[model samples]
Target chain A: MATSIRFDPIRLPPETEVLRGEVRAFLAEEIAAGGFDPRGGYAAERFDRSFSRKVGAKGWIGMTWPRQYGGHERSFLERYVVTEEMLLAGAPTRGHFVADRQSGPILLRHAPEDIKQDILPRITAGECTFCIGMSEPDSGSDLFAAKTRAEPVDDGWRINGRKVWTSSAHYADYMIGLFRTSAPADDNRRHGLTQFLVDLKAPGITIRPIQFPTGKHDFNEVVFDDLILPADHVLGEVDMAWKQATSELAYERSGPERFLETIEVLIELVRVLGAAPDSRGSEGIGRLVAQLHTLRRMSISVAGMLAAGEEPMLQAAMVKDLGTNWEQALPGLARDLAAFADSSPTNRATFDSVIQNATAVAPKLTIQGGTTEVLRGIIARGLGLR
Target chain B: MAEADTIVVDVATRIFQDLGDPQTVNNAGDDSWRAPLWQALTDSGLTLAWVPETAGGSGGARADGFAVLGLAGAHAVTLPLAETLLGGWLLAESGLEAPQGPIAVAPTRHQDRLTLAQDGTLAGTACQVPFARDCDSLALAAEGADGPVVALVAGHDCAIRPGLNLAGEAKDDVIFDGARPRLIAPAGADRDALMLMGAAARAMQMAGALQTLLDLSVRYAGERKAFGRPIAKFQVIQHDLARLAGETAAAVAAANSAGAAIEASERVDAGLLLDVAAAKIRVGEAAGTGAAIAHQVHGAIGYTKEHILHRFTHRLWSWRDDFGPESVWATRLGESVAAAGADELWPTITAA
Candidate 1:
C-alpha cells in the first residue's frame, strides 16, 4: 500500500477568529501595560508568574480540557489561537505553559480523579508550574535507555535518577517524569518505563541550573535521590508509558512554539530593512514570509486534525522537522538580509540584540522536544520503511 | 459539498488513470493518447470547470477545478486542462462566453505583457504560452488604456513560435501584431490576478507530482535490493525518503491551503495574495528538493526515459518557472510585508 499522508485544508473556525481578536487585543494591552517585552527573544524561558496568572484569568490556560476540571472546555483550535498569539507577541509563558499545554492534558487522560481535582484547578489558575523529565544524562533520544528507577515502597514509590535538560525545573512545582518500574520483557525493550507525577517540593529532590553558553539559565539537572511519591502518583498503566508517550507527541511536537521561536528576528529584520527595500532585501524577506506562511498553514491543518480527534503523528513530526529548521535558519537569513539594509541607530541596536539572542538559541531549536534525527526516523516509520 | 467534490475528483482521477497513465503514455511513440485523454476530459465537462453554467461551460466549484489540476500533474497529463479551465474562467469573469474545445491563456511568464489598443487591436508578445499551438482560441487579460480588458482571440490570428518546457509540453510564444480579437470586454481583474491563479494551479500540480514521486520512491526502495537486503532497510535511504515525505507534505499542505483560501473568498486581497505566493514559492522549492531526493532514492533506473519518474520530475521543473519563479513572488511578498510594517506582520498573517 502507498504511504498516505493527509493534511486536509482546515481553516480555523469562525469562533476561533473571535478568540484570536480577543487574544490579539489582550496581547496588545499586556504590551502596553508592560506585562512582558514583546522584543524578548526567548519568551518561553522567561518565567513571569503574574503574566501567566493574567492569561489564566482570561481563561486561556487549560482551555481545551474538561470544564469540570477548571478548564473552559474550548476546542483545541481555540487553544491554538491563544498559544500562537502568546508566542508571536513574545509573552512570558514559561510559568504555566507546560501545564497548560501537556501536563494538564496527561492528568486529564490518566491521573486519578481526586488528583486531577486537586492539581488541575491550580494549573488552570496558573498558580502551579510543571516540568517534563524524560531525557536523562545518558538517554537523550533513545528514551528506553533511561536508567531512572522507581522502586515500589510502603504505599509509595522511591525514585532515583537524574533528568538533564529539564526546562523550568528550577521553579516548577511538579514534574511528570518517566522512571523504570521493571526490567525489559524479553521481546520489548521499551517495556519497563512508567510515568509518575513527582512533586518537586518532596524530599530528596534537587534542581541545579544548566546554564547556556550565553550564560542564561533556562534548563536544569533534576536529580531525584530516593524521591518518595504516593502510590496514586503513578499515571496511566504500569509499564505502558511507551503507548501513552506516543499519543502526547502529536500535541507536543506540532505546536506553534516549534516554528515561532525566532520570529522576533524576522520581525526585526523587516524593521531594519524598512519599507521599499531593494530586490535582494525584498526577495529574502519574501521567501521567508512565504515559508512562514506555508509552515503556519501546515501547522494549523495539523491542529484541526487533532481537534477532530485524528492522530496525525506523521504530519505533526513533519511540521516540527520543517518548522524548527526554518526557525533555526531565520536568524542567519535575517543577518544576511540586514547586511544590505539601512537602519536607524535604534532599529539597528534592537535588531543586533534580537538576532544575537536568536543565533545563540538556534542550536537547541532542532535538538529540543525531539531531535531532527529522531523525528526523521519517526517519519520513515510512517512511510513504511521500517 | 464535500461528497460532490469527492465524486468529481474521483471521476477525474479515474479518467486520468484510464487514458493518461504515465507508463502507457511514456512507452507510446506517438501523440495517440492525447486525443483520447482530452476527449474524455472534455466529455466530463472538466475543461471549463472554473467557468459558470451561464458562461456556456461547466459550473464546477473553483476548489474542485483546482483539485483536478492537481490530478493532472500526478498523471503527468500532456493536455491543456489547466490552461483551458483558466481561460474559460477568465472569459466568464468578464461576461464573455467561452468557445468550445481547448483554450490557452497568454502571458504565462510574469515578465511578459500584452496590450489592447484603443482601435480594438491586440499588440505585444506573450512568450511561453502553454498549449498555444493547439488552442482553438486564446483568452487574454491585456493592459488597455482603461484599466485592463479581457479578450478572446482566435489562435490562427496570432504569430506562433513553437517552444517546449522541460517536460516537452508545448509552450509557445504568440505575437499578436494588431490582430483584432473576436470578443473584448472590460475586466475587473489585472495581470496580478491572472498570475496568482496560474501560480496556484501550478502549485497544486507540483504538489500532486511530489506525492507520486514519494510513492514511486517508496515502492522502489522496498523492491530494489542492495547489500543483501532491500535498500529500504538502509538508514541513509530511509532518511532520504523521510525528507522527501516532509517536502511532499509541505507542498501538498501549502497548495491545498491556497486553493481553499481562493475558494473561500471572492476577491484576491492581501491574504489571498500571501496564500497564493507562499504556495507557489514553497511548492516550487519542494518540487526541486523532492525531485532530487526521489531520484537519489531510485538510483540509475529512475534517470532513464523508460521509467515514469521523469514524467513527474520534469513537469515539476517546468511548472516552477511557469507563474513567476520563486524569486519574483518572494520579492513581491516581502515588499508588501515590509510596507505593512513589523507590528502589522503578525496581524496580517493571522488574518490570512
Candidate 2:
C-alpha cells in the first residue's frame, strides 16, 4: 500500500479471515484440558497464565514476533486477526499482551541485550508478564515530573517512591518503570527520567489493589521502600527513561483494541434487530456500521505505520479520541435498544454484559489512555493551532 | 495528496475569513447571512457545482461542492445554497433548464397525483415544498403507484402557503391544485435512490455548518477574555472547545471520506450509504456540541438573534436534528454490523 491513502484501499497482505474451526478447537482444548472459562469471572481482567501458556504453546502468542524469539513471526495483521478472535472469545491475553505486543518490542529496541535475551523468549513462551509503572502521585499528564528517586549504590541502585494507577502490578512478574535518577528539576525534564526493569518480587516493594467503585481490582497503588536493583536492570541508558517511556506509551495508546472495545455491544445490538430491522433501526445500525469500518481502516493504517516504525503521533491521537466516543456509546445505546426487548436470550445476554461493562467504565475511556482534552491538544498542535 | 487536500480546505478557510468584509449578510436577513460570499462562490463555480458540463453545469463533483459548502456553512451563508445547487442539478439532469435566479427545489418526496389533460397540460399538488417562495421553480415527486415521477413546477404555477423552516428558511405548503407541471423525468423512478443523493448532499452541508460553528466557537474561546486571560486558558473551556474541535474534525473528515468514495464510485455503494449515515451522526453530534460550545463561548450575545454568532449557532442548532440524530444513525450502524457478523464484518468494514 502507498504511504498516503488517496484512491486505493489498503489490503494488509498478512490478514487472514481467522478460521473458527482452528480457534474453536484450540479454545476447546484449553477449556477442557487447561480448565479455563471463556468468560473467566465477573470482572476478569488478569491474563490466565495456564491458558496463555497453552495458547503460546499453540503458536498463538507473539505470532507477529520474529521466529528467533520463539515466535511464529506472523505479520501485524495476522496478530490483529488473532487479537480480535481472542477479545471476541473474551480470552485472557492481558497477561502477555503488554509483553508480547508492547514491552518485548520495547526491549528489543531499547533494552540491554541481557534483558532482551532473557525476557523476550519467556514472554513469547507465556512464562513471563510485565506491568507498566509510570504515573506517580503528583505527575499524571506531566509524567516527566516524576519524583521517584534512585541512587547509584555499588553495583546496583536503591529506589524509593510511590506509584499510582499501576494496573496489573499485583499479577505481573516484571514492571517497566520510570524513576528519577538525576537530581530534581534537571534542565531537560525529558532526559532526567530513566526506565528500569524491576522485579515485582524484589524486597521492600508493597502492592495494594485500589478497588474501583465497580469493585474491580484492576488498578493498584504500588510503593517502593528503597528497593534495590542491579546495574543491568536499566533500559536504554541512565537518565534516558523519558525516551523509552515515550515509545512504550505510543505502543500502549494506539492499536485496533482501542477502537474495537465497544464492538461487542455493537454486534449485540445488531443481532437483536433480527433479520429485518425496521427503517429506524436500519438507519442507526447502518451509520454505526459504517463508522466502525472507517475507523478500523484508519486505525489499521496507524498500526501499519507503527509496524513500519513511523511516529504518527497525531494520527494515533485522532483515532483514540474518536474511538473513545464509540467505545463509550456502546453501553448506553445497547441499554436503550435492549429496552425494546423481544430479543433472543443470547442477544440479550451479550447486550446486557456489554452494557454492564460499558456503563461501569465508559467515563474512564476518556480519562484513561489520555484524556479527551489531551488528545485534542495534540490534534490542535497537529493542525498547527499551537 | 494530504497536502493538496489541505490546500482545498485552505480555500474554504479563506472564504470564512472574508465574512467580516462588507458583504450584505445582515441585509440578506435570514437568507443573506453571507450572500455576497456565496455569490463569489457561484462566480468561482462553487454553486451549480453538482451539474455536469454535458448539461451546461459546473461539471464539479458533489463531494467537492460539499467541502466548499461546509466552509460556506462555517461562514454562516444566508441563502439556501445546497438546496439550490442539488435541487437545480436534479432539475437540469431531468431535462429541464434550471431556474436561473433564486431557486429552492423541494429535493424531497411529494407528488400526491399528476394528471395529464388531452392538451399536454400537466397538473399536480405536492404535500410540502421547501423554500417554496424563495424558489422560482419547485422540483417535487409526482405521485405514482409504481414509482414517483420528478415534476418541476414553476413557482408561479402553484398556490403556495409559505412558512419558515425552524431556522427560518422558507417552507411552503404547496397546492398544485389544477396547476400546470413541467414533466422533468418519467414516473415510477427510484425515489429511494434519489433521496439518498439528496440526503448525502444535506448531510455534507450540515456537516460543514456544524464544523464552522465549532471552529468559530473555539476561536472565540481562544480570543475572548474572561477574568484575566483568554477564556481558553481555562481547562474547562479548553476541554470543551477541544472536544468540539476534535469531534467536528472527525465529522468533517468522515463526511469527506464518504463523499470521496461516492465520487469515485459514481454509483451508490451500500458502504457509501453507511459512510453517509455515519457522517450524519457525527454531523449531528458536532452540531450539538458546536452549538452549545458556541453559545458558551459567545456568552450572552449568543442567545440574542442580533448577534452574528446566533447566525451560525441557529443553523447548527436546527440542522443537528434535521435528516436524523446521532442515536438514529448509531442504531442503524449497529444493525448493519450485526447483520454482517464476524465473518462478513472484516471485508465490509475494511472495504472502505
DockQ of each: 0.83, 0.21
Give the alpha carbon lDDT tens digit for every residue of B33-103 in model 1.
98989999999999988888887787998899999998888888888888998888888888999999999
Residue A219's lDDT within candidate 1 is 89
In candidate 1, the residue pairs with backbone N, CA or C atoms under 3 Å apart (3 or more residues apart, or in different chains) clash, namely: none
C-alpha TM-score for every candidate: 0.98, 0.79
| Residue A65 displacement (Å), model 2 | 6.4
Candidate 1 lDDT tens digits, A1-386: 18767878888888988999899899999999887888876888999999989988999999988889999988999999999988888999999999988898899989999999999989989899999999998999999998899999999899988999999999999999999999988999989999999999999998999999999998899998988899999999988999895657898999899999779898889999998899899899999999998899889889988888889999999999999999999999899889987789999999999999999999999999999999999999999999
Query: Candidate 1: lDDT over CA atoms?
Result: 0.90
What TM-score does candidate 1 reach?
Answer: 0.98
Candidate 1: give its CA RMSD in angstroms. Answer: 1.3
> By lDDT, who's the top model here?
1
